[model samples]
Target: MISEKERNVFEGMAIPQILLSYNNGKIKIELVSDSFCNMTEIDRDSIQNNVAELVHPDDLASLSVCFLKFVEEHSNLDVMFRVLDKKRNCYILIHGTGLWQLMEDGTEMILFYFDDTRRIQNSIRHIYSCLKEKDPKAEYNDAVTGLPNLKYMRRFADEKLNSFGACITQQVLIYIGVKSMRSYNDRYGYDKGDALMLLIAKTIKEEFPSSFCGRAVEDHFVIMDEFYGYENVINKINSINQKIKKNAYGITEGIRAGAYVVNPEIKAMNAFDHVRQALKDIGKDMNVICRFYSDERDGELLTERHIIESFEEAMEKKMIRVFYHPIICTKTLKIYAIEALARWIDPLRGMISPGEFIPVLSRYHLLYKLDLYMVEQVCREFEVRKKSGLPLIPVTVNISAQDFDYVDVPEKLRKILEKYGIDSDNIIVEITEQDIAKGTDSFKKQLCSIRENGYRLWIDDFGSGYSSLNVLGQYDIDRIKFDMAFLRHIDDNNGKNRRIMKAIVNMCRELEIHTLAEGVETESQLEFLQEIECELAQGFYFSYPKPIEETKKC
Candidate 1:
């Protein structure tokens, strides 16, 4: 019942509209816009008879509710439904908004229009695309870089190692570390970081197409393959580095690598730890680029892990025993004192060396336990000797820098000595020059407390790193033990070490601090130390580190 002017206004307006006459649940389309009929491809006559015929069967129920709501409220209406365009034989979603109006004859009709739903459908599809599965086979590939993730690579490595048989020993797994990546990420941005990672991944794929490459963790990539040796691995890593530099990410970045040779006898997870060990060995020195695993180092790492895993039980079972290496007095040519060293005598794994377990203890922050254990063993041994009427000598127990972090060193030692009814002077403490070089207040205070309590202190492995005569003026130390490394290279470059050792020993003598030389295996080395006036010495030439029972025989 729209008037002429209103109908003209509706026709001129650019919108798809339809006018319906509603009476008692029956709907009759009275008027339709030309645009609406064109869009739906249905003529006005067909729609005027019954608009319900064009509505999709599934959307009819919802559309009926919308109409009922509009009649009850007598207000605006908005609803979404699908329509079947019979001409095209396709369903088109539509959003309709309208208002209910009363005519002059008291009849009610709904005036409405619809906009296409294609845009909304497109948006929904876009959201779903973001969540599409990256790795359908569950290889756990990273969505951004398209490289296998850590879990997938670990599984792959375990399977490869387990099935490779005798050929496993020849296989090598290499890990590449991007230096200063965290600072780079912070300075530039995450987008650039991700870009660099993608570039690195692409370059790796091109360089080692046959090898299995994966992201082990942030800024670390793992590549597994059979290479000829360390030389071949070095060449390949260098090539990859060159390629990365010349490519897009123009930042000055460097890469270092460590490799592990497959050990068929051990688990793959343990083998991975070996590669990490190599990196730890040389990663700090920028001069080295790549290092390969050695069987000796592998065994040492395994032994260290075994010690850590079993240390507590070993201590309770008395498996960790104290070994003594005699320090000989140069003038008397007799045992003056013994250096107390720890040995893990595992009943199942046999003997584990101090060299193997010491670093592990430091890494796990458990060196304090070992240090305290060593001191207690020394105290008990001295007490037993005194009770048995056996001769007792001062025992030098080495303490680690990490020990200071864990306890009051002076008080702990005092208690242990008191518990065994021994004087502090009976047990001397040896600390490394490197540890002292840190010049920590705690270290200085502990050393002063020990010396004040009448216990002697020795500087072990002196001249090893950053050693100087000025150090003698800084602390009250009793003896300086020359490192074995100095003796190993004594003949290097025509007696360069000989002159250095002589000068060092002379300097210590002038300072009135006693000097000891270790690793004097050959008679020539002994003669040189004796000639140089080293006050005390310990090495295989005197005696190997032996158990308490073996000391009497020596």
Candidate 2:
């Protein structure tokens, strides 16, 4: 009944094809094209009785069910599954379509098989790529959370605002952030971390159905929607906190949310920036759950960005100048030394405060450049002062904790000193107590080496952080500059701060360590510090931080 022409036409097809016949409740391959044999690497004789073995074990049950359904309905069968070849180990992802046919001999057969699985996957990938080009949000979705990623969130915010036909009142962007998720992941496994993230994503999506929710990188989720008023949102956040806390999976630290009410004139990207800025302010305080963006928040990211981008150029142009504040001997009222401070005067932006730009540099790991630049400036300024017939006073330069972490601080400083032909004794290396407390054995050794090289090592901001007194015993520190905060209310002899200050001064005295009081602004503060027998002090009371050029003239 089958014509040679029909058989030849089937064989001429490019795609893999096969015909199956049902006999004794088992499906057997009756007709296979040469293309199918070549693609699967199996000959007609080898596959005749072992057709069932060619199907992947995971896919066999589903394929059998599909065949049964197709037979009963006499409908077309379209299924996507994996099939093994002659190698048995290698599987081909496949898309097969079967059509049931009744031969003239009254026997039933099914015809199916097509191109390999990899081709279909590649085609699908191409389609997704095209979609991503047209709509970027389609491209950068988080696989774990099923939410738009940081990249997509930024573009989506701007586009959504542009498309809004009317102004919506009190629209806000909220950033929900989880703290120490990395530590959590380390304690548990990545699977648990993924599950927790999924749970968090699900909770957020369910809670704020009206909002546009997105994952702004790891452990940071963003929601843009109408503000629920401060009280309502706070209550909602508390509710979320309780839920997450109850199901915390042994995680002690909870989540915090920060909000920024949208300023319609401002770009959506900037508005979300306000949200991130607010989130950073919330920080690690467990008592604080949410914070709103304020205009008073230290610095703007625009200014921060400008500082980072222009830092190298600023240094090259000598726009970043080193100024010194005199630290006088309390007993003699003499200018014993000066602390080198960095001052940035941007040509375009005028004067950018260290308070504004220092943290920016630190966050981006660029603070080391600024610190080293200050060292170079200090060395250069010392020579300039000496050449100008002004006294070359010993200068103390603050080295950031980050510098010691990455670079050889002592080695680098020694090289710079050698380059400038200056004695290490004329330059003091000032590191924070926090730095010394957290430093490793290697860092401690670096501090000792700096000291051995004739550089005086002073612990700056000694009483400010949660540093232990044990640091004084651990490292080779020459002096301890007590934080200004310790002297804030030293005027009150009965106050706890004054008592603690007295105790610290006494403790340092016992260790034969010299103590310098910082921020001695008022007459009363200075008198009290002197009464406590503090060795040296620096403040606006004596003189403000002045450039070497200005000091030379003075």
Candidate 3:
């Protein structure tokens, strides 16, 4: 087994690295991991004599001085020089210079390397920079602000695209547009509008700190860089909105963004499609950030646009169907509540998942009608079961973020329930985590009102959205369908991501509200939760989603 100190550098280097120790004139390469040996074409036992043996003849003195300074001064001296390989061929080199103690005896030595060929090409026949130095005149430019234009997005994107060629590391791209800038120009005078644009750019610069704030278009600014991470960017984006409200005056700060991390290894031009997908993800919301532009996001945007034209056919022609997933009483394993999952029975696709069309329904504001129709269908199902001497079990229906605040949702619910002779108590309303996280106070109040009207309010996908604390506490909710992400984490014992999930469940339990874990796929995971004394749960281990009749068979 490799010693601890030696193993650290070799563990994740899928590339190459070496650890060497020297005493007097005697030198030894203590260890070289698989990557390093394969890369260097030299066996460790063969290179154990003089440390200077591997250095190119011309670089030996410079390498020696680099080593001496590291030993004497105890500082980093990152020097890139050429070194000869096993075949005596000189090649690009890199050294990670530091004074490393050997055996804790205070016998320190210089630590450096042979090849540092990973970064940008040497600009001056020396060190490499990550971003290639492109001719300045050739990059993208905005005609309005004289900044790098959208055309240049591809240029800068080239450097940042991930190993997958996807834009990822730069946590995510933030495409910003100051909406109504033209309106400001028209109403408040062009000078005031221009002044506002400059202020907008300045504010983004000051606000984001390290972000590349450039005017990418006439009324838009793009902040490019590793400006944010996947985890915190959503909340940070919200903070920017609040900040604009506090500091921005007549600007109104209507910024819309299409954020994407180019897939590492993906070509630059293709990454632009990801940005466009993000724009569509934000979907007519002028102030929202942290959205993806691909069908990966809410596929419903396109589905909804298509649904708008098809809503008449969908409703009048009887195309929508209700697929029920049993929300079981975990203790008894009895189906206590049935979640009415909306399904689209397109004339062609037969049955389509909610992932296929719900987004489209939400986008076109047709969700109110669709949700009401489901409510009516479910209420009628409840009534039919009651009249036939079957149990009048509760039915849960998912609601849209847009539908929650629409003035007519309550009225429609009341009319549908009353017409079906089903009490409001039989109907439960569930909204997704992302919905409540992104919703306004009115949205929260809208949900609170429905629950107040004797309908239960549930938060679904508990771990997958912002506002975990709120999803468990702040937002008014009756039950939290603990996103299965919590259970999925039990297999990872490193305490990395699972801790966030553990906190959510514990917080929800402490609140004295019901917590239901969704997507329970593994017995060990379920055993893990049971060990934690969690009571409520749902998933394939319990039940999979199916049509009402299909569920009856199961």
Give the range where candidate 2 is weakest over 10 consecutive residues by summed lDDT.
161-170
- TM for candidate 3 is 0.47
lDDT of each: 0.80, 0.80, 0.63
Q: Which ten residues in a row have the lowest lDDT in candidate 3?
A: 123-132
| Tens-digit lDDT track of model 1 for 1-554 | 56888667766566789887777876676678877776677787787776788887766876788688887777788776667788888877667888876776787788888776575557755664555544264447764577887878766777866665356346778888877786555334345677878888888888778777888888889887776777788888888888777774547476788888676677778778878878778846877888877888867766777878899998888899999999998778888899999998989988877777777888899999999999999898986666666568899999988888779899999999999898887888999998888857887888788889988989999888767667789888898899998888889999898999899888877888889989888878888888888888889987899888766733
Candidate 3 residue 37 Cα shift, in angstroms, is 83
Candidate 2, residue 268: the lDDT equals: 81
RMSD for all candidates, in order, please.
21.0, 14.0, 23.8
Model 2, residue 143: distance off in Å is 9.1
Clashing pairs in 2: 93-117
Q: lDDT tens string, model 2, 288-320?
A: 898989776635756877888899999999999
Candidate 3 local lDDT, 18-111, one digit each (tens): 5656667545566555665555566655555544676666667756786666656757666545544665454535444444645555565544
Provide the TM-score for each candidate, comma-separated.
Answer: 0.65, 0.64, 0.47
